[model samples]
Target: MKNTKTPDLPLSIRAIIVAFRVFFHLGWTKISKKLGTDPTTVQKFFQCMQRLANGSEDFWYLLSHIEPSGCHHPAPLIAPGSEESLEVRKAVLKHKTWMRNNAVNYERSKANLPPLKCTTVQNICLDFKHAAANPKYPKRIKRKRQPCKTALDEEDRSNWLQYTQDLEEAEAESDILTNELANKLKDQIQKLKDTVSQQQKNAESPGTLEWELLQQKNMEICAYNDAHFTPA
Candidate 1:
């Protein structure tokens, strides 16, 4: 018997279904304002479309009218020893060479800094190694020596001492800021882990059936929206 159900679908209903498929593939945000419908409603409609399309021949026929052509062809597979592979290797080598040249240029630019005394350079390197070995090791600040202020007037002596004190205070403040930032980041990570654990427990709980269903629906909506909607 001829399917009476086929003729029962109104033309307007079919048009809306096709329009929704296009909009969902293109993006829901694009048509929400034009359709005067809430984005959430459009999103739910999209999920319904997906479920219907998956199970119903009528829905599949409606969807096929809007389904894009030429999208089903498998991407061309590249064989080993192909020109494409050789070109990719060449591109990688070119990038490596460019990076090496930039590093050399950077080091050359820094070469003009005042040369460190052999003893000072050795001490700095040693301190750096110690800090790497022991996280709690204090960093040494480099201090530039000024000419003896005692040989100058009393005003010069007072100015030198003030400058040194200011330098010490600035370093202390910087260390405090670094410690505070590390602690803040650690706390944030712990909070994120706690939130994830709570969500996993909720998912596994018997009482969270509704919540899980809502999440599944939401994922379907997102998939439908991604497939149909066009970005502005």
Candidate 2:
């Protein structure tokens, strides 16, 4: 964590707690108004504090850096010297343990409860924060988020995979056909080019007018013989 100099009093702790609130999506304006300070000043302090937390430490401690670690529902407020509080504390810890490992909605659903509002959770966090500042406050803990299960089932994934494979196979077949067509056309073009070249060479040969006419007739007869013997 970066070396940060918070005020050497409860105001500094208040500021740190406010920064934590800000990390939980609370606006700086609301916190500042409640604390009777300039909104921007509170925001500046929070940003500085976040920068100082170098992010290579405890998960809850890392919340000082504003890194997303899921919704941290504040630790339950435990009053001092209460005998009946033991069971309440156990229940609270059990619920908090779920919140720490899973998303709010997921945990709520697992407990067969309706989804809780984020604002409600934030208010609870503030209450806990106040309780934490108490002389006999116990553990300071919060919720952590877990990755949600994918919506697509096995059938959908398999269908998508097959669809992708089919497209690849079609593309590969098209490429092969395209190459074959190009090669076939290239051979035909080369044959036509050779025929043209032979005609050009024949044109330059010396001969009498009558002999040249007879030569042309003979060449035409040979061409006809060759073409007539070829397959349809």
Find the candidate with the highest TM-score and give its number: 1
Candidate achieving the largest lDDT: 2
lDDT of 1 at 91: 29
Q: What lDDT is reached at residue 212 by model 2?
A: 84
Per-residue alpha-carbon lDDT of candidate 2 for residues 1-232, written as tens digits (9 for 90 to 100)? 5323322224444545544464566676776656655566556555554455652434355444442222234654434324323323333345553453234456456668655455444333335543344334454334443445668789999999999999999999999999999999999999999987876676666664555876889999999989898867
Model 1 spans > 4 angstroms off: 1-150, 213-215, 218-232
lDDT of 2 at 32: 61
The CA lDDT of each predicted structure is 0.51, 0.55
Candidate 2 local distance difference test against the native: 0.55
Q: Candidate 2 has what TM-score?
A: 0.27
